[model samples]
Target: MKVHFIAIGGSAMHNLAIALHKKGFEVTGSDDVLFEPSASRLGKYGILPAQTGWLPEKITPQLDAVILGMHARVDNPELLKAQELGIKIYSYPDYIYEQSKDKNRVVIGGSHGKTTITSMILHALQQAGKNFDYLVGAQLEGFDTMVKLTQEAPVIIIEGDEYLASPIDRRPKFHIYKADVGVISGIAWDHINVFPTFDNYIDQFRIFAETIQPGGELIYSETDEVLKTMVDGLSVDVNKLPYSLPEYTIYNGITSVLYSGKSYPLQIFGQHNLLNMEAARLVCQNLGIGQADFYTYLQTFKGAARRLEVVGKNDNATIFKDFAHSPSKLTATIQAVKSQFPNRPLIACIELHTFSSLNKEFLDEYAGTMDAADEAIVFIDRKTFGQKKIEPYPAEVVKNAFANERLLFFNEPALLLNHLEQLNIANSNLLMMSSGNFGGINLIELKNILL
Candidate 1:
């Protein structure tokens, strides 16, 4: 098959392009810009565009398919040419659903935990010698690409995201999958730019749950009250299997799940992570993997990239980096780090980088979310507000929104780094949480200076 991708430098789009190229398809792609990793990977595969901008000439009628990425605008020139040529053009996930329509899909969806749950399932399936294809969000250690497609795989595990499929197709990506066995970790309002209201954000998951194949199962977190309430009202025909926090214990900072007269030690920790493990366990069970085998395979699974990732560690100090700008994610990450090392002090710093996190209206949701941390710090680049066109608010206003008296705010990265450098993390744990790089603050340099 001859395929061309418009805006292929996207995280998901680039991975899919690579997967298809390795599958023996004739792959070509173009993008307006190419950043680190994506540009390097595409170039390594000899598929990176020779030029930077889109060209109508690349949209030839001979092309079998044009995969559209979210980064592509609706009026993209290549997209226009493809429409004129009457070639099949699809949103990335739409193309994925098209390819896997014949296979039973395990689509995991939620505001958070989807990537971890999907990673857990993929790891376990690989360990069991199960033949399966997968499309995950983050890069896993054992996987070559975030997406894997094969003609022979009977099942395709997907980390279903609730974000828009593309600029042209405003429908949520998961809505296109039409999952055979779906998973919803829980809902916490995110992507406020696309989903303007909390109700609007939640309704996307409702549509996801209702769209599952009639006989398939919808595994979800029963412990999330908001999610449970929503799931209870749904009238879908599929089996609605709800999961809760499993029996587990944390001893010496190691977490384990108890089942069938034995405890299975886990490399990962946290109540939220345990809940995610339960969700993964349920999905594996529905796929015919026994409970004992699931835990056994999960023992080796480290974690998804940037999800409570251990960046630096030593005898007295441990530093973690996590993608946790959202309120629930930030709270969960901080609680995880703090709870895991109860005896040690925790200094948790959060970067307000995303549109939602930078918005004044949404800042209120972060109230008391950082209470578990012994020292709470927030960093926001002063330039971000101007770029986002949001008026700069006083630090006191942010402090008031968080309702934390001891909270410290930094509008500059250097000042934040200076503050952190002065603090002795000798017997403490440091967690850096953000969806961004904390305004170009280097974690490696920070780790070197502190640890």
Candidate 2:
């Protein structure tokens, strides 16, 4: 089969193209801009466009299918051409569903901890020597591609993001999967730009729950009261499994899960992660994996990239990074590190990067989120506001919104880096959180200095 990709430079789009190419499909893709990893990887596969930018010629009817990325616009030349030719077009999630329609689909969905839970199941499955098609959000250690497609793999584990499927398709991506097994890690009002109100944001999860195939299973975190209420009165045909933090204790900075008073050491830590593990364990059980085997293999799971990832560390200090921009995520991450190293000073730094997080109204949601840290710092670029065509917010505005009188804010990268450099690293742990680079700060270089 042959497939053409429109706007293939996206992280997920390029990865899907690579997966299809590896599966022996003819893959051709075009994008106006292509960056490092995606560009290099596509070039290695000899599928990189000889020249970048959309080409009408590439969308001919001869192509078997056209997969559209969320980055592409409705007016994109190639997409318009494909539409003119009546070519079959599929959104990334739409195509994923098409590929796995015959197989059992396991979707991991929620506002928080979905990636970690999904990664955990993938790790466990890989370790148990199981062959399964999968699509996860992060670049995992053992998996080469974020997406893998195979005809023989009987099951597919998907990280079901609740974001819009495509420019033309407004439906949430997870809702399109129609999962045979579904998991809701937790509920938090996020993506305010799209959903606008808290109720609207929550309604998406409710829809996702209702979309589970008949007789399918839904595994959810009981810790989130909002989520609890959402799944409370679901139809009787759909099975519901609620999970919580398994009894575990941290000793000398190591977290171990306790089963029948026997402790099993874990490579990962934090109560949130432990809770995510419980959700993952339940999903694995549905996939025919036993409880003992799941725990046995999960002990070696390091975690997904940028989910409280330890980038650098030393005897006196450690530097970690995470993809946490939302209020719930920020609070959970800060609390996790503080609990993990109670004696050490915790420096919590975050960047107001996304459209919702940068909005003046959304700033107050962060109140008390960084309170657990010895020092709390927020960085945002005034230039970002200019680029986004939004009103510029002063440092004091952000400081006031957070309601932390001691909170420090920076509008420039250099100033932020300078402030961090001046702090004494003794007996401290640095937790950097953002979905964007902190105004182009080189984390690896920063880690070198801290370590």
Candidate 3:
């Protein structure tokens, strides 16, 4: 098969391109601008474009299909050429569905826990010696690529994202999967730039429920009231399985799950992760894996990358970097770190980097979300405001929006780092949370300084 990717230097797009290349397909891609990891990885695979910009001439009739990335504009030259040639075009998610249509698709969806749930399922399936293909968002410990497609695998585990599929296809990525078994971990309003309204954002999940194949099942988090309410109103014929945080105990900063007269220690902690584990377990059960087998495999699961990952630690201090930019994710991550090390003071720092996080209207949603930390800090790069074409908010506005009297906000990275360096972190835990880099702050350097 021959496949060409437009704007292929994206995180997911590059991974998909590599997966296809490894699958014995002739892969070619073009991107106007390629970043560090993607550029290097693609070069290693020998699939990197000769030049950086799109060449419409590369879109030929001989091409089997064009995989479009969200990074590409609607008027992208290569895309226009492909359309002119009457060639089939597939969005990243659409192409994934095309490959997995014949297989039992287990899609892990929701605003927050999709990556963790998908990673958990992959870990358990690998441990059970199950042959399966998977597409997880984050890089896992054992996985080389975020996407895999093979003809022999009977099932495909997909970390279903609710974001728009492509520039042309505005539908959420998960909507195209038509999952055989789906899991909604939780629903919080996000992607305000795309969905615009909270109700509009939620309707996407409702559509996802309706997209499940006949006789399929939906595993949901019962603890999330909004998700539970949505599940209750689901008119789909598929069976609904609800899961919550399992029985667990934390001892000396380690968490363990008690099940079936056995105690299984977990490398991952936090109520949110436990809920994710339960959802993954139910999905595994539906896939024919027993409860015992699931627990046994889950013990070795460290966690998905950047989802509360411990980057550095010492006897008295630990530093964690998490991909938590939204309100709910920030709250959960902060609370998790605080709960795990109750004796240690917590310094929670978050970057308001996302479009929603930077928007003045959405700022109020973060109120009290960082209350678990002894010290709460918010960082928003002033340059980001200009890049996003949004008005820069005052530090006082952010402080007021969070409603935390002790909250400190910084529009400059140096000042933020200075404040952090001046802190007495000697018996404290530092949790740095953001979907973006903390304004080019090297986490490793920060960790070394704190530790």
TM-score per candidate, in order? 0.98, 0.98, 0.99
Q: Which stretches of candidate 3 lie above 4 Å from their native place?
A: none
TM-score for candidate 1, please give it: 0.98
Candidate 1 all-Cα RMSD? 1.1
lDDT of 3 by residue, 300-323 (tens): 999999999999988898889999
Candidate 1, residues 1-451: lDDT per residue as tens digits? 9999999999999999999999899999889999989999999998988989998899898999999999889899999999999999899999999889999999999999989999999999999999999999899999888999999999999999998898889999999999999999989999998899999898999999999999999899998888999999999999999988889888988888999988999889999999998889898898889999999999999999999899999998899999889999988988898888999999999999989989899999999999999999999999898988999998998899999989999999889888988888999999999888888888998889998
Q: Count the backbone clashes (under 3 Å) in each candidate.
A: 0, 0, 0
- Evaluate residue 12 in candidate 2 and report its C-alpha lDDT on the 0 to 100 scale: 90
**Stretches of candidate 2 exceeding 4 Å from the true structure:** none
Rank by TM-score, descending?
3, 2, 1
lDDT of each: 0.92, 0.90, 0.92
Q: What local lDDT score does residue 142 receive in model 2, on the 0 to 100 scale?
A: 83
Q: Between which residue pairs do clashes occur in model 1? A: none
lDDT of 2 by residue, 267-338 (tens): 888888999999999988887788877888888999899999998888878899999999899999998998
